[model samples]
Target: MIIEPRSVAIIGASNDQDSVGYALVKNTMSARCDVFLVNPNHEEIEGKKCYPSVKDIPYEVEAAIIAVPAKVVPDVLKECGEKKVKYVYIISAGFAEAGNVDLQDKLVSIANRYGVKIVGPNCLGLMRPGYVNATFAPYEPKSGGIGFISQSGALVDAMVDMAKESYGFSAIVSVGNSAMLDITDFIEVLDQDEKTKVIAIYMESIKDGREFINVVKKAKKPVVVLKSGKSERGAKTALTHTGKLATDYSVYRGAFRQAGAIEVNTFTELFSVSVLMELVGEVDDMVVVTNAGGGAVLASDYAEKYGVDLIDLRKETIRRLDKVLPEHYSRQNPLDIIGDATSERYWKALDILMKEKYVKSAFVIVTPQLMTDVDNIAMVVAKIKQKYKKPIVCSFIGGSRVKNAIHYL
Candidate 1:
């Protein structure tokens, strides 16, 4: 189901400026995909003959991206139903989230009867950068690593934007309102997919808690989750919108841990875990190294919350570090080297840390004023491949001057 599409029909196809239809057509064409434009009144849109309806299209489409108004969705879906399309991306809005539980029931009902898997009635849709794209959020990343699933449109767009600037993604999925098919369905499908090595998700709620928990844990692949909507205000908003969650924060947190998934608090942290997953694979323990003691201490404190052991280097290892690391540096779990360390010193420490027995993974922090030669440090990090079979994540916290030099070169 990843990329075996013979053709796709874009419902609500139009040539109007700034139309989602126009953007979708452009994006689809860019991928050189066989496309059919579906619209009742248009003769042609973007040089592609506009079929009056999905039924009129000669070829069978495996997927249909419906961009028409929500009111007309059922009719459009009805047309797709007759054609027996397997996958439908309902990009229109104003469904269950509009406070119509009855309508929501009807939507789910139709999908179940027809054997159609729906992404959303109010979603941006999924983007397969490697092949098929169901979204119109404007992303053309150098596709390679971590796949993304999110609920919010703005956030989904942000993820695409951030990926282009900071990292590469295998795919990006937008889960809005969860009318029928939700994140778990997508996760189940992607877990078996060969192209996707890692999965990062932004979950506000789960539709199938037990199934979802079971699927993710059994995936045996690196999965990073950033669960939001925990506060009273957030809970009220989410509950009012999605009908609420019976399980509380602690319950969800425990579920993530038992499933062997790393649960991060923020979106940036989620992306951080995702980016590092490309380098580090399935870490059971971590070593924290930072130039600032306070920052290192705080990081170690949070590391304990996930049951990830902060393995301190042994006395033998400390003796080796003492031979190389400066006098003021602490050789323990949160290895704190004072402010005077340079990129050379950081590289040496990294070289030594890679040799340490207990450290399965490590996080390096270098603040703005920590040092110069940021390019040199980036080179060192890029050079240190997964030769030792451990994941290494580096965070560049340097000042504005060396910001570009800090992250990957």
Candidate 2:
């Protein structure tokens, strides 16, 4: 109900333009559902009548976004329960993360008595593009295939801005403090969402380790995890941030492997792997065709490190490539066609590699040289990508020279 509510009430609505309450009201005004504002201090905000409480609303509210003070959360949640609201998202802070365990416990107790699911006591709320923007994020993300659940709300804000042009999201959730519902709950829900092709998670700690592994193992879609708190100091910092102690990094890594989840070290790898998985599903036999030998070598090293199989070229495949590529071109899996190669060489080399029945996907690397036609090569790559309907991750290596080509791809 919280992810896509039919009707929602914004508790603690305010007129102060800089306040979180005001931001919540403003962001949610564009949602496709009914939105009601509540504030005891104001009669109306932006010409809309402000109810004193959830009890004052005339109709049923499927979800309530609470942005009130920490001390008032219990009362506000109780009122939501009396009004039969199924979901409540506590956007306010100063809960367990602030060492206020008693206050957090009180809110949780009230929620269970009313059979309500709480999203957070310290979080940024949720967002479903083109449906609802239930967050204070400065920029709303464009709708696409990735469903991202993060412990750090600020990181979600950053990702929204960075991915605006490169990729998009099906939904964005910030699981703050995890007083009631955790990352596992969101993962289970998003796994069944047809629009979400892949699930990406930025986890600080796990509330229930056994349950997390079970959920990921049974997930039909791919699960990519970016875990933090690897160092002792980092784990302590995570505890202060989310009120949950992160276990040893090795333990979490082993668990992820056992559950068949892909674990990435950096944010760049997280989405790169996700986009690849979304487009190609899984590839057992892969190859790299690059104009730079060094780039191919680096790719080979990483492929070995990450367990990606870069299959060797067969004799027949090499013979076919020999006709198109220069005689001196490297004939192995990372088929380096020499740095000075032009777009035609790239087109022919990629065409031959993609046609091999044994080859499933490819990585095409292009380095800017004096003779390289960066823009034309990008067009050729785009054409080949459409023709084969196979995954082709491109690395247009260089600054201004390759910028246009990168954008075209």
Candidate 3:
């Protein structure tokens, strides 16, 4: 499986600080696996002895990362096959996407002959949290419930850095070119991983649509997809990017919904929805708690636009809120606590809202007002969030003044 490897060999390991090969070798220094550097030209890289080839290494290698020039990838794969490596990650480019489709096929054929699973031919490598930092990305993500599979290696880098607080990953695979093991294969692998409670993907196109739908439909956890290539021009761009023909956007959209995957339009929505899904399973009935009336109104309108159900508070619940809130406050779904709200006020409101049977989760939107204690409110929200086993997302919608509040959450 891509999530765990006993040992790894950097087939094109190098010492040049500016090259991709250098980054690959440098990033693996912290990998928990046994890492071997391989290069016929170098005696050693980063103080690790460089093996002449995979076959030359004395120990068995589970994963071999091909980082040499595209022309040398076939020979490298041959060495990996002879060495009996189970998994391979090809970081070299100039394959199918670069008008070298035959060369890409040859690489795939070698892997199939050896019964090896390939992650990529022209993409960033995969990273298993606490196991290996195989990708060229500089940071290693903290282990979490989301398993992210991406077509764009650059997007993977951005997402890994973007993750914080509750949003992190169990594993990340950049299925570039997907010469042998495509998105479907990786999805099937993650679907069975117990650590992964949620699956997120960034895709330009699907390699096998039918298999993809079948696998996703049977997934036990939530699947979140951020698909590109909607417009004619964008589809053409995707072709140039991944060397795969982009299907009609409508077909992909419908298929994703049919397979029970939540298709998102932007990167932000993809991660936001994924975080909420992992944190609060199958929760749709949400309460919007805000200090500003306009913020509440806007949230309510967007909730309807996005097909999110706003739980109508029970009469008894409203009465309880009425006792806790000011006289002018509206005791509705968007429980506006007025502009001069304090942390305790927010605490009492959230405390009551969370108790309602219909309220599964909440969105705490705080528009910074002159009298609003932003930090205190954030503290209260954080405290209340801990007591409940539900999702609570905070939107401290402001500039420099709200930085501390965001940090607290």
Candidate 4:
């Protein structure tokens, strides 16, 4: 109901331009649903009628967003329950994370009594592009394939800004504190969503380990997790951040491997792996097509370290490449097509490599050599990718010179 609400009520909508309440109202005003603003002190805001509470709205609200103070949350939640609102997203802070466990417990008790599901007590709500912007985030991400669920709202904000011109998202959720609904619940929901091809998570801790494993094991789509709090100092910080203890990293890693979820170390890897999985479902045999031998060596080292199989080129595959590539080019996996290669060389080499039935994907690496046409090579790679419908991760390795080519790809 939260993701595709037919009608929504903003419980603490404000007219003050600087308040979170005001931001919620402004961001949600464009949602494709009936929006009702509620505030006891205001009769009208921006020429629209403001109700005193959810009960006064005179319409059934599928979901309600609570942005009031922590002490005031219980009463507002009870009002939502009375109004039969099933989903409530609390954007207010000062709960368990603030050492106010009793206050958080009170909200949970009221919600359970009313049979309501809650998203957060200290969080940046959620966003479903073109449907609803139930968040105070400054940017609404472009609609795409990844469903991002994170414990850190600020990280989601940062990712939104960084991914503005790059890949987009199917949904973005911030499950802060996880008082009632945890990361597993959101993961299950996104796994069933047809629009979501990949599920990316930024997790600090899990409420239920056994249930999490079960859910991930049963998930139909790919799950990519970027866990934090691995160090002793980081664990204490994470505990204070979400009111949950960060467990041993080894235990989590083993569980993730058992459940077939991809565990990434950094933020960039989290989305990068997710995007790759979204583009090409599951691939094992990969080949590297590069213009720089040094780049190919680095790729080979990483592939071996990560246990990724860089398939050995067959005699026939090498024979086919020999006709197109220069005689000086390395005639093996990570087919280095020499540093002084042009777009035509890239086109020919990639065309031959992608046609090989044994190759599942190609990693095209290009260093900005004196003769390298980065932009044209990027176009050739895109064309070959489209023609074969195969996954190709291009690494145009350079700054300034490769920026436009990277953007074009």
* CA lDDT, every model vs. true structure: 0.76, 0.89, 0.86, 0.89
TM-score for candidate 2, residues paired by index: 0.91
lDDT of 3 by residue, 1-409 (tens): 5678889999888888888889989888988889999999999987889999899999989898888899989989988998999999998888888889999999988988988888788888868887788778867788888889998888888877887454778999998888888888888889899888888899889977888899988888888899899989989888777788788999998788678788788999988888777877655789989988999989988776455678888899999998989998887888888999988899999999887767889999998888888999999888888887677878899998899889877
Residues 1-409 of candidate 1: C-alpha lDDT, one tens digit per residue = 7333567888987898598888787777765457788988889887879999999988878888899987788878877888998878888877777776676567677878888878777778657775767577877666767878777766888777776867777777777777877878778777777777788998888877788889887885688999888775776677655554434777778888887778998888898878777656666567777777777977877777655677768888788789888888887878887776677887778778877776678777766563556677667666654456567667776467556765454
Candidate 2: worst 10 consecutive residues by lDDT? 276-285
C-alpha TM-score for every candidate: 0.84, 0.91, 0.85, 0.89
lDDT by residue for model 4 (138-188), tens: 889889899999999888999998888677799999999999999999999
Model 4 residue 194 CA deviation in Å: 2.5
Error in Å for residue 290 of model 3 = 2.7
Candidate 4 stretches with Cα past 4 Å from truth are 272-282, 304-309, 322-331, 340-345, 371-376, 400-404
Single out the weakest 10-residue window by summed lDDT for candidate 4: 301-310
Q: Give candidate 1's root-mean-square deviation (CA, Å).
A: 3.4
Which candidate do you rate higher for TM-score, 3 or 4?
4
